[model samples]
Target: MSSLVPPAPAPALPALLTTVLPALESLTTALGIPRTVLASDEEIEYAWKDLPRELREIPAPLRGELVARMCVAVSTGLFDSAMNYIWNAAILQLRAKIRNFGVPIVAQILQSDFEERNLVELQDSRLLELSLKLNIVNEDGFFFLDQCRDVRNNFSAAHPTIGTINDREFTTFLNRCVRYALADASSPRGVDIGAFISAVKGARFNSSQNDVWVQRLSETHDAQRQMLIIMVHGIYCDPNTSEPSRLNALDICGALNSGFTASLRSELVHKHSEYAAKGDEPRHTASLQFFERLGLLINLNESEQHAIFYRAIERLWTVHNGMNNFYSEPPFAERLLELSKQSAIPETIQDQFVQVVMCCVIGNGYGVCRAAVSSYEQLIRSFSPREVALMIGLAATPATTLSRRISSHLSCSQRFKQSLTLIDPASVPSSVRATYDYYTR
Candidate 1:
């Protein structure tokens, strides 16, 4: 990847208007209009279909003229006119002939345009690159933003396909749901609370419905659904609550359910706030945790779903600190630990989350930070020798200096000696125990 720093800021828009806009206007004035107006969307499409042929037959000077003329249309608020030629003709030519059409073509286009006259006006190289990656301009690409009617018609007509949902709408619903939970007028009575708790239990395996209901709750200002989720969790975590009661059972499940749900709600809220506070990073870590929580709550067992969770978290930890740091916030870690102790979380998930955090520490350099070194020791102490040995092998290859530092610390630590001593040669697999022996020695 290129290491070029972001360009300086654009001169004020007025300066841009005074300079490039007028040059563009003069160029357009010189070209004048063709005999007929390409006014409508259909006419624009027809024009685009013919453009490739014209571009081929015309000389490079004339092609440049057309590009300059089209720039005027784009600048002058002739959206359809501009899009017709460039989006269909120029963009398609590059997409078919160019190997990596997305970023390079976009960069070239931005560079050649009058828009690039100002040093700071250019978009980030990475941002332009990623937009192409996600949009998939090649034949095999999944997303296309072109305004061609055929493409739109095909997409709309495709059936039995996974429907798309808006992150903004889901997040809006989540915030409203969380707020409603805290806004109930009075404390619950036993029967009403019991029924509420039952609904929370049902919600665990019905999370998609829960999502829709949360949106509904937001739209209607009805706190009933959300309040029940929080209420059941609160009650279930209370030791004094009767264990066998239906409400208690609901609370136990709901507590775990809300633990995951609430974490996502908080994360999305944090991200939304962060983006508003600062500009977006080119590569945003996709939140697999949010989807994983959804999958678990909804009883989804697809392998791809599982892979998405793992991949998302892996990419997340890679880009923005470690997984432990990501989840170590009080509400999440505390609840997860509580769930672990209470036998609410499945053993597999517990192992997965634990390993993920440990691996993230290795990946992101968290393990080697002087401040976190002691915390790393405390972390290893919390794990059984068996689990620790498993982690050592899993981290055979360290991606960052922090990971190497962690390896060094473990190799030298007294705790490592004690942990190694506890690794029974007979009970543990030779491969697992051998990894600990090799690392510590």
Candidate 2:
């Protein structure tokens, strides 16, 4: 919950190094070993002087036994050994973060059965990847920690040394380990996914139950919350889900809707599109309904939007041409109007959308659908500039159904002119201004 504050420098570090360095030199001399085999005296002193500042960067909770050993190794000019110890400390900190983030939740996110054994066996690189995926580490942390992992593998005593690192290189390595992995203060509490799912599926949540779950979701870390949102969406879109469960999902998602970030929205869209791509018709239809229920239809891609508008127009057109057409048309017309209010009609479908709505408004040789006139007027008044252009240009295309009707039926032609009057002059594109003027004139 809180970041560890840096403690004062270890009082014994300078004196301990002063004693250890001479004895190490004497032993090396007695053994007839080259002094160059270890860090030079100047290098050791430079590293030792800089070590305190870097040590202060490590959180107090992170300066464990391994970190103490790393400081001792550094004092003796065993930079490689120091690297190994510090890297161990960093790795341990990352593992602890994963454990605290809840292993089962991690398993859910990975879509695999990850456990303590799996956590323990993860290679350094994979651990970093998981950390990034779970938002345990930000991108910068992942980059630097991955580099540190490579350093531990190649340069540290953990593996055969590829090359010697300078005092500066060692300090840089220590700093990255401390700054990226060791210094992170957040202790993200994991949600109990088992209990969460059971509750969601068990019953319709009352207001109090809803508030509690919402609070729990709000309290979890971003990665876990994001996953839970997606899961809830799946439940909502599942055709076999009980009605109460569906409403439960909706209540939760709707409450949290305002807090949805772009990343969250993108994930939902990806899942929705996945259903369509796999030809999962039931889930796809339910997904579309989900979006519509949440009023998130605007987040769908252009092609999806075009399909939605196209289907809606087709339904309205059918009702307009059927028995009891006037009464039946209003609801379909009103639904289409609601959809247009949700987002701009995709340009790919705009011409068709305009043609159908205008045709419905002008009606057949019998009469206009008076009961649906309000819905039709509302749709017309809300048309975008491109739609306005399409509407005006329909008069020029006499071969089209609306233009044909406008020419043949006096009432249809007059109603078409009244529809033109509903369009705002500002929304008429300049390219269609002449056509608009010709129709109105």
Best by TM-score: 2
Error of 2 at 217 (Å): 4.7
> What is the C-alpha lDDT profile of model 1 across 76-169, one tens digit per residue?
4343444334333333333322223223333443444322232233332333232343232322221223223232223222222133222232
Cα error, candidate 1, residue 70 (Å): 99
| lDDT string, candidate 2, 1-441, tens digits | 999986766434555456877888898999999988888888888988888787776777777899989988988899999999998898898899889888988887777899999999999899999988878888999998888888888998988888989899999999999888887756576778878888889888999999998888877778788888899999987888999998888888888888988999999999998998999999999889888778888999898888888889999988888898967888899889889888999999889899999999989899978988998899999898888888888867878988899889999989998999898898889998888888788
Q: How close to the true structure is residue 206 of candidate 2, measured as C-alpha lDDT?
A: 93
Q: What is the lDDT of residue 330 in candidate 2?
A: 84
Model 2 clash number:
0
lDDT of 2: 0.87
Q: What TM-score would candidate 1 get against the native? A: 0.25
Which ranges in model 2 have alpha carbons more than 4 Å from their true place?
A: 1-38, 45-76, 104-147, 153-163, 211-230, 254-280, 295-303, 314-338, 341-343, 355-382, 395-427, 438-441
